[model samples]
Target: MDKFTTLTAVAAPLPMINVDTDMIIPKQFLKTVERTGLAKGLFFELRETPDGKPVPDFFMNQPQYKGAQILVAGDNFGCGSSREHAPWALLDYGIRCVISTSYADIFYNNCFQNGILPITLPKAEVDKLMDAAKRGHNARISVDLEKQEVTGPDGGVIKFEIDAHKKHCLLNGLDNIGLTLEKKSKIDSFESKQHGTQPWLYAQAGR
Candidate 1:
């Protein structure tokens, strides 16, 4: 996981509701556990035609939105199955943040674990950002986690609320594994004490 303190980058507008996990990476691409190459399969059906050619009209396929690090999406984003791969694909495609009016609970949790910031804002605010994102190369959205604020291209700022724990995790780049590692010394000490207290249990393990 990477620290997500602040970001100022191009935001691609995806104004479709109920964008599910399958629609994100597709079932065919779910066979691999590796995260790197999943970007090729990100929004595969929406991005490609029957013959596997790129869809010219798709937001992601457009040249101006290439390398976009933010996504301003519609409501119910990341719905359906609780697949961690959805966030993996999004992160691999360089989407560090997703701003929507709402999101599925499972997918929202998965985003934080994978270092993707899933933001929930009111419909009016999201609509404004979506419009800013539509301005092509000129509009770059800025997100600051510490301040819990999003600055649109036109210099308008919108404040958002997030759980303090989640904010801390993102600021420190702490995933579940990273959080556990932070207590390694305590874990080691506990294990050492347990070993001394239960010699017979340790001996049975040796068998």
Candidate 2:
């Protein structure tokens, strides 16, 4: 995981509601656990035809939206079965932040775990950003995690709320493993004490 303090980049507009995890990376691409190559499958169905031809009209396929790091999406984004790969694919594709009116609970948490910021704003505010996103690379959306604010291209600022603990974890680049490591000394001490008290627990297998 990477620290997410602030980000300013072109935002790709995805105005469709009810975007599920399958639509994001597709089932065919979920076999592997590696996150790097999943970008090729991000929105695979939307970006390519059944015959494997590119969909030139899709926002992601358009030249202006290439390398977009922010996504302004419609309501109920990432709705469907819980899949950690959804956020992995988005992060692999360079999407550091996602702004939507609503999101599925599992996907929202997955974003934070994967170092992606999933923002939930009112419909009016999201709509405003969506309009700005239509301006292509010219309109850059800025997200400041510390301030919990998102500034649109028109200089409009919208404030959002997030859990304080999650904010701290993201700011410090602490995933579950990283968090556990923070208490290494305590864990080591506890193990040493336990070993002294419960010698049989550490006895050799043959014994």
Which digits, one per residue and each the tens of the lDDT, describe model 2 over residues 1-207?
899999999999998999999999899888998889889989999999999999987888899998899999999999998989999999999999999999999999999899999999999999999989989988799999999999888888899999999999999998888899999999999878978898687687432
RMSD of 2: 1.6
Task: Report how far off residue 77 is in candidate 2 (Å).
Answer: 0.8
Instruction: Write model 1 residue lDDT over 46-133, tens digit each, in one string.
Output: 9999998988988888999998999999999999999999999999999999999999999999999999999999999999999888
Candidate 1, pairs of clashing residues: none
Which stretches in model 1 have alpha-carbon errors above 4 Å? 204-207
My TM-score estimates for the predictions, one after another, are 0.97, 0.96
